[model samples]
Target: MSEFDQHFPLFSFPPSKVPRLLNPLVLAYIGDAIYDTYIRTYLVSLPHHKPNHLHHEATKYVSAKAQAHFLKLWLPHLSEEEQDMVRRGRNAKSATIPKNANVLDYRHSTAFECLIGYLYYKQQHKRLSQLLKMIIDYKENEH
Candidate 1:
């Protein structure tokens, strides 16, 4: 968290490590940052790519439509427990949508991120990596 984040607490975790009701929207918020970082990392690892090329590649995968598509691909693979988490995140009520995203698209993206966050919180690194690889694979195959 940076100074701006500290000053503006858009979402704050409850006092408990695990709240009675996990907020999927909050999970999505965190996942949004994580996802961007992951995409940038992937782009940076590629040799001989210009900054513009990397940005385009990252944008293609991170767009609302792409994230929603990935949600469909990954949702079936989650364990029962993770499915519950995803459900909570998906059904979470939220007041705002991203400026660039429509309501349906934004909600779907949030749901997908919530699933990723849930997996990460559970320390299911292998599972998360596998799911992410599927998403990346789709992006690669698109080219």
Candidate 2:
């Protein structure tokens, strides 16, 4: 078990019951929350602690454009099955898009979030951590 699994002990759905059965958008919903929490936790661990500063900093990583960028970087590295999940997410239509976000970026971001949610529900915590860590490392090196 990964260190994160040991510490957090997620009550994931049975592997046979979810992911395939759930809607891609539903997966994106949970994935969005999970990703946001991870980003918030990482920011809190840094020198900045003020709520406003943290929120601003978080937007850099959590925005649709940023997520789409990360997804593009990750595509070549993903397994075929993982890529399928991303495809499902990217193709899933939504009723609304944020005014500030490009449609393509928004779709890609949903794809990214869907992958995150799939991993989470499937209890692939180690892989999830690895993928999320890649984003953190990439962002840290960007400055």
Candidate 3:
């Protein structure tokens, strides 16, 4: 078990049970929260504690455009099965689109969130951490 599991001790269903049971959008729903929490924690660790600055900086990472950009960059690194999960999410028809995000970016962002949710529920903690680290590294390098 990794340090995260030791500290957090979240209960995860078996991988075999997850994709078969949950809708892609449902996965994206939880994934959004999970990613948001990770981003918030990361920002706070960097000492961006002021509320307004924290929220503004978070939008740099958590916005749909940003997520979609990261997803595109990471796609070539994903496994075939992982890619399929993204495909399912990208094709999912949501009831509404955010006024700020374009359709393509929103779909791709959903795909990214779906992958994160899948990895989380499947308890692929190490892999999830690796992917999350890649995002951090990529963003940091963009300076």
Candidate 4:
């Protein structure tokens, strides 16, 4: 178990329970936190920058536009099951809409978050790392 797992036992639910117990939006909710944490932690690990600069840099990666772009580029690489989860998330209706993103981008972002949530809940850390690395690589290639 990771250090956080030891500290927050309540968050460590069995992977098998995920499908039966949680809806897509709930998964995306958890996913939003996990994805944001991953982005912020990665930014902090790089060369030092002002807090505002760091936040600005993170926005380029964390926004709905970016996430939707990332998903589109990576879709062909995903397995059938992963694609299915993405489809489920994209189809889920949400009461709230993001101020900065269009409906299509928002749906894609939700799908991306659902995939992350599935990986995280299943404790597939290695797969999660691979996918995150792909995102980082995409960022690097963009510039």
Per-residue alpha-carbon lDDT of model 4 for 53-142, expressed as tens digits? 899999998899999998997798898988988998899899999999999999999999988887778776767777888888888798
Residue range 86-110, candidate 1, lDDT tens digits: 6787778888777898887777887
Per-model RMSD to reference: 6.9, 2.1, 2.4, 3.5
Clashing pairs in 4: none
* Best-fitting candidate, scored by TM-score: 2
Clashes of 4: 0
Candidate 4 vs. truth: CA RMSD? 3.5
Clashes of each: 0, 0, 0, 0
Global lDDT scores for all candidate models:
0.71, 0.89, 0.86, 0.81
| lDDT of candidate 3 over 1-143, digit per residue (tens) | 77445433465444445453789998898789878988887888895589999999999999999999999988989999789989999999999999999999999999999998888887788888778888999989999
Q: What does the lDDT read for residue 54 in candidate 3?
A: 94
Model 3, C-alpha of 16: deviation from truth (Å): 12
- Over all chains combined, what TM-score does candidate 3 have? 0.90
In model 4, the Cα lDDT at residue 118 comes to 79
The TM-score of candidate 1 is: 0.79
Model 4 alpha-carbon drift over 4 Å, by segment:
1-16
Cα-based lDDT at residue 92, candidate 1: 84
Error of 4 at 27 (Å): 0.9
lDDT of 1 at 133: 76
